[model samples]
Target: MNFAKPLPNYLVKRYHGWKATTYSENQVWYRRLATEGQRPRAMVISCCDSRVHVTSIFGADQGEFFIHRNIANLVPPYAPDGDHHGTSAAIEYAVTALKVAHLIVLGHSQCGGVQGCIDMCKGQAPQLEAKESFVGRWMDILKPKFDLVADVEDSTDQARQLERQAVVASLENLMTFPFVSSAVEAGSLSLHGLWTDIGEGGLQCYDPKEGKFSEV
Candidate 1:
């Protein structure tokens, strides 16, 4: 319980710089956000990859997006077992409490979590297969989707396809939640799946009707 530590020097310096410039320039807006609270219109469930900048991609300002980042951006099927479900909890809060109109699952290229899921499913990552490995258990949510891309011959192509599949899988799982589905059925909520190419700075969105992701 004594593991907490002070902020690193670099981060502290960066914070000071941001506070002096960005915070000073937008003090009024920041104060209003503090007093009025956040009323974000959308909730973005994205991978925890540092390269995936959700705000920058959308050109969003403060209090614009309610974002939840996790490995592979996977959402498990609605499980009301009273276990510690961080992703599910975030979704519930966003949909039921925040009442966000749009819920987006954002996946990105070269996702380590997706790669890990692929490797683990192929029996290549023995460590992740261990019962005690949190990452392994979490990646299990995407294991079923691995088979969809397993037939692809090239490793790189396979990984890329699986990354998109990860987004699709999460969107499907989101519908399993009663509140999410109810909101959608009532036309109060919408779901989207997006994939970004980190290297090329390209984006694609899933089209449920076409059954594929198209450039956006």
Candidate 2:
């Protein structure tokens, strides 16, 4: 805590401005959310990319969405090892505790995490290939997907294809959670996969019937 000494002046000023503006306008709503706890309608699993703004893109109000962000927006197959699984923990909390109606996995183009996986698979990243690398181990969930898109001739195109597959992979993995699958089968929960093109600001939704993402 000592390293986090004083708050920056600019951030302090911005906090004050927000407190006076949005916070003041929604004072009653904020109070209600605090007292009654959150009942978010949906849980969004998205990449930890600054360019992918889930709330802003969806025009969501505070507490409306239970958002979880991780590298490449991936979800490993349900593994209850009792280890420190941050992403799995968040997913468990959202599905079992929050009981969100919709669980959406959001992926994006030009994802660094996906690119890292590609590099690792091609033996371009020795660091990621090491057993001690946390990121490399985490991205192992995505290594299988590389083969799914390996036919693409272009490297960048292959990366983009892999990125989209990450969403589909997460959706499939979500069903691996017993609680999540039961909820879905009971008509209490639904699953969705989405991809975004940050450079063009385009959004696409995966069509299970069509087996591809189309503009939304």
Flag regions of model 2 displaced more than 4 Å.
none
Q: What are the root-mean-square deviations of the candidates from the true structure over C-alphas?
A: 0.9, 1.1
Clashing pairs in 1: none
For model 2, state the Cα shift of residue 56 in Å: 0.6
lDDT by residue for model 2 (1-216), tens: 567778899999999999999999999999999999999999999999998999988999999999999999999999888888888888889988999999999999999999999999889999999999988998999998888888898998898899999998899888999999999999999999999999998999999999999999
Candidate 1: where are CA atoms >4 Å away?
A: none
lDDT for model 1 comes to: 0.97
What TM-score, over all chains together, does every model reach? 0.98, 0.96
lDDT of 1 at 199: 99
